[model samples]
Target: MEFFPYDVKELFKQIESKPNLWNRSAHEYRNKEAREHDWKAIYTHFEPNFDKMNRLDQKEIGECIMTKWNYIRASFMRTVKHGPPTRRPYVYYDHLKFLLKSDVKAIDAPHLDNNDDTLEQIPEKKLKVSPFLDEDTEIF
Candidate 1:
């Protein structure tokens, strides 16, 4: 199923309105039953005409939404959160800013220990050359 840009934007709005769906620390986020209930509610809201008779259909709907959600999240992380100054912000960056309200850091700094002596103590191993690649070796 194809989702229009408007639908996706509205979907993000829906998720934003419900903290349990987006907030990682929410108790409902970790609760399987609560999470499934929320997804069922979301599915009904977006798919009023469809009937969720089988578990597969519900799972498929959830997967589709998750794929889109992940894409939006990854784009926000790359463009707005970690992008260069010249890079343009993602279209939904403002809509999803609530996601960053928690302890989410924009950029993760690399952990570096400035110990030069430790590097010098390690010896490099010599690699054995493959006999098949050598011009002096013949294949039987």
Candidate 2:
């Protein structure tokens, strides 16, 4: 069985232990979700104009896109490597961010190297041809 962080369980237990605490905690948790949703709405304000953006702005947009792409890729890697989470407060998102920020370059470097090696391994072949050969050649 998977285990949750001790503090998370402790907080849940505390809320369950008292009726007033349970009510307050439930309200606070729901409000926290609402706040996060509002914050996400604010992120939309930074929308970039692809055509008008300068090189640096484009680069920044590219980096953000790459970061999110890497996060998704790393999440899959984590699920494959560590198995699925079984409890609340799973650290998958945090782990994804960490891998995107730190491990992505190293993880992708090997794949790039392998691609180069594969290309290099293919043998170069040359076919011989007559420079002045006509369209038709007479043969008995």
Model number with the top lDDT:
1
lDDT tens readout by residue for model 2, 1-140: 23321243333233233323213333444565654443333223234255476778756654553354345455645653454565333354333322322233223222222343212232334545566766575433
TM-score of each: 0.61, 0.28
Model 1 earns a TM-score of: 0.61
Error of 1 at 72 (Å): 1.1
Off by over 4 Å in 1: 1-6, 50-53, 84-86, 106-140
lDDT for predicted candidate 1 compared with the true structure: 0.62
Q: Write the per-residue lDDT of candidate 1 for residues 10-119, one digit (tens) a residue.
A: 78777777778777778677787877677667777787743645778767776787778778777775664445345444677567667664424333312212252222
